[model samples]
Target: MNFVSTRGNVSKIGFIDTVLMGLANDGGLLIPEKVPQIPAERLQAMSELSYQELAYEIFSYYVDGEIPDNELKELIEKSYATFRHPEVTPVQKVKDNLYLLELFHGPTFAFKDIALQFLGNLYSYVSKKTGETIHILGATSGDTGASAIEGVRGKEGIRICILHPHGKVSKVQELQMTTIHDPNVLNLAIKGTFDDGQRIIKELFADVEFKNKYHLRAINSINFVRILAQTVYYFYAYFQVAKETNTKTVNFSVPTGNFGDIFAGYLAKKMGLPVGKLIVATNENNILEDFIKDGVYKPGEFKSTYSPSMDIQVASNFERYLYYLLGENSEAVTDLMNQFKSEGKIVVNEEQLLQVKKDFAAHGVLGEECLQTIKKYYSETTYLLDPHTACGVAAYEECNEANDFCITLATAHPAKFNESIERCDINQTYPIEISQLFDKPQYLEVVEADNDEIVRKLEKLFSFSTR
Candidate 1:
């Protein structure tokens, strides 16, 4: 299948090219030329299939003929074997109508591992097939860095460098990225917010010459493969619920920051999965909520909240959604995004606004509400949740009163955000290694929010390594 850029300027490309070129050259996200549909029979049979078998079934369509079926199946099996849970992503009923899709049962204790692990395996399979090396760069607010590091570390013919805001992530999150002293891994604590780090990575990708010279790839959700891997769980969750409870329409409430997680649900719906509602949950950085409600996109200052992963003002994946909403009118998306960049706002027509609200609902909770959700759930149901999951739980309560089954994504393990959990009066502590991560020496570089500064640092790093 071919992929097209959201901005409409870049030429349509194949899946492997789209995977390698994280961000489109026109400063837009890449989406499939067409959303492939899954037959009803396959969806019905998905409940009996293993996680790897299901993943191979879903992803093979997107991979086209690039990777053979046997190799792809092996990659899927090996990637998910790293997950701590045999089911890969299990569902737990938190309320009568609400269930928590526990997604942190992976090596890195975050939802990102569900996809990054598989993407790492796919990278290995592709590299072996093509006889090439890959350098992966990613920007993370918290979990993505650690998860990507865990997935890509020690893999031959692969090098990964992650950029995260220095003080934004929790100690355990920071330590998870830094403690892995793998020769193939490099961690940089960017002296800015996650947005700054993300911007730098985008700028680096825009430099086609630099990108090719270093064989740069991205581990971020911008990679279609990352989203493809994530899509498997949505189908898996739906079928699991269908088999256990015999339910048809399952609603998903995702605690979202960058929009990638919920977008996966949209892709599932596009593929004819029996998904009911795609609830978009947010923290204090609720730009997504505002945009979905009003159809006007405006990014504000990043808020430091209990759910640091959701502390994003501008979501990178929103552009891809805009492409679909605009009926794949790349020129229109380009114009709107440019207007947003310059004027800090862009308004959609009433029809477009109606279209968005019809399929999606959004709500944001304060930090206090997140903590209270954790405390209330723990006291009332004896179920523990991290701050991010708390946001999703609270949002779910606000939007949906009763449904056959509503699944809120548990984004991170409670151990990663011990401070937030304890502040809610829970008497829990993280691992000893987590407690000691604050004392480890960190290596990073401070830079201004300029494309030139990012380019210079990347060039210096590349030159020094080669010499």
Candidate 2:
């Protein structure tokens, strides 16, 4: 499966090249030229396979020719071996017709681990094979910075610099990223919001000369590999829910920030998975919710809520979805994106809005409402939710009218956001792995959100010379 840019200017490239090259050279996110379809027989056959097996099956479509079959299988197996759970991502029945797809069993205790672990190893594998030094850079809200750091901490020849919003993320989230002292990892808490960091990351990547000089690669969901890796769980979760309930279809409620996770679900649906309506759950920063519920996509003032991760006005991955929404016409995608950048919003036509509404549902949950959902779930089902997942749970409850069971992605462990949990009068026994994080000395540099200032810091921080 060859990949092309959403802007449609870049030449077609294979999977390995796509993995190594994060953002497209033409300043657009990468997408497969074609999405592979899975027939019903294949879906039934896949349900019986283990998580790793399912991953290999789903990943093989895009990843077939570049990486050898045996090597890819081994790589996927090695990545999941770090997870604490036997099932890398398991499902918990919270109540009848409602479930939590637990996705926090990895090294850093967040869903980002599912993709980063594999991406990190893939980088190392490629670096070893090609004898090239690989430098990675990206911005994160909370969980992604830590998970990306955890993915490549002491791995040789792979250096990553992560930019996060200073003082905006939860304390545990901050500690998770800032405490890592690996020379290969540089954590910068930028003096702005997640949207600022995201913008900075995109701006830096847009400079083709600078990007090529540094051999820069993105670790963000803008990296199509991460989004592709993320789609496996949607298939796995759908298979599990369908088999258990004897239903033909199942819905997923994903708490979204940059629209990455839910976009993965959208890909799964396109790939012929019986994925019912994908609920795009958001916190106070609800640009995605607004876009889905209404035809207009406008960025409001960014609000920091209980779920800091979703405190993003600009959803970077939204551009990829827009490509498909515009009939995969790269010219139209380019035009709309240019308009969005210049005017700060994009509105869809009635037919385009109708098409999107067919595959997705969206809602914005409030801080107090999130807290109440956490309280209610913990009090009733004894299942604790991080603020992000609480937002998903609330949305799932609000949007569901189907008979089939719905799975809400439990994106991060509850312990990662104790500040939100505390407001619900809930006391959580911190995981032994997590409790040790507070004891570590943090290593981070505070920086302004300016792209040039970051470029200077990154040049100084990186140990290797440019290729």
Candidate 3:
């Protein structure tokens, strides 16, 4: 259960420390020192268990009793209690050989809630054990901010600061993060792209003294716990399909910007889920799509698309995948990332590129294609998809070469993107949780990308909020 930095320099650590020390000191993503493998029969045995049970079984491979079993179970129960659906994430057949795994059943109505809720509870446990407060710093394009806020809002011994790209997210997405009045939740609408905000967080974390002084932690998928929580759903979706349809193999199409969601699917495949293809779906900001399809990792202008959440040119979690793709050679990953940072691009060797293509297929859907997918799917199956989910569906339809059935991860509720839904001549009645967000007064600060100014503001805000 020990974890190591992807750069191969940092010392090995356990799960809890990895969770706390987000980005590795060596400027690499943390990955399990040894990825636990399961046999197909063992994975199938997990099908009969409930989501909570499945999660417990999967986490056992990572936690290794870091948190006592009973306490972990309690946290899991508390985290999932807020989900509106009996199945935290339900799988529905949208068409023949095409399914949608609905993941927006939690309080924040985004896939992130599943992980953030667990993380929030975990933080409470950690704070009590160490008798120290933690400051959570994260950059979100859309859903992560709201979900992370909801996770730690009003919780004791923790203060969360979320940075989001101002005016780049959907109205509901922005409102979800901005309207929260929790004194412990500090929302910053940065006057830059999500990549800028993300870069700021990484820069701050890379500063050893500054990171230690503030006890900075992460809620992004960069945190291994978030990725672990997300892995459960892939198993859940696979088992759910196995139970009813008896499908042996399934392909997952995940609309991802940060690479966390699909990376979870990749983990499931590595852990021996009969995953045929892990489809990396993207909007106009298709750095991931281009990189996976080709061997070149190049940065481009961050395009604001209908799917604002996917409007990211840089995918942070890609490093973790590179750890696996490069034969677990951390030095190679470190060199590649350093090159990408300095040159704004990195080209992989043919062998490395071939390895990437074997496990994952990537495609980018344009804004118009996303909108049309939403309208077309609604017309055919009466299934309303958010722009992000629409991109997933469109990618699957356009680039699917697998013979197995497809399961597109519906990352968010359509109600969260009402304007995009309306573009398809549809009106959505949001749930009471979302509808009430409009009535709440927003409390967010605007800041530039300067690290010192942002840190100063955080210090001032922390003092004010704590007092």
Best by lDDT: 2
Cα lDDT tens digits, model 2, 1-467, are 88999999875799988887788888888999999999989889999999999999999999866889899999999999999999899988889899899999999899999999999999888988987888999899998999998888888878899999999998889999988887788889999999899989988898989888888888999999889899999988887888788988889999998999999999999999988889999998988888897878999998989998889999889999999999999999999989988998899999999988997898899999999999999889888899999999999989988565799999999998998998899888999988998899999999999988999988976756433
Task: Provide the lDDT at 227 for model 2.
Answer: 93
State the displacement of the C-alpha of residue 112, model 2, in Å, after optimal TM-score superposition.
0.4
lDDT of each: 0.84, 0.90, 0.89
Cα shift from native, residue 14, model 1 (Å): 1.9
Q: How would you encode candidate 3's per-residue C-alpha lDDT over 308-385 as one tens digit per residue?
A: 998888889989988888889988888888888788898888998888888889889998899999999988898999
lDDT at residue 83 of model 1 (Cα atoms)? 78
- Model 1, span 264-374: residue lDDT tens: 899889999998888899999999999889887888778899999988987888887888899989889989988987898879999999999988999999988999999
* TM-score versus the correct structure, for each prediction: 0.95, 0.98, 0.98
C-alpha displacement of 139 in model 3, angstroms? 0.7
Off by over 4 Å in 3: 464-467
Rank candidates by TM-score, best first: 2, 3, 1
Worst 10 residues of 1 by lDDT: 458-467
lDDT of 1 at 340: 86
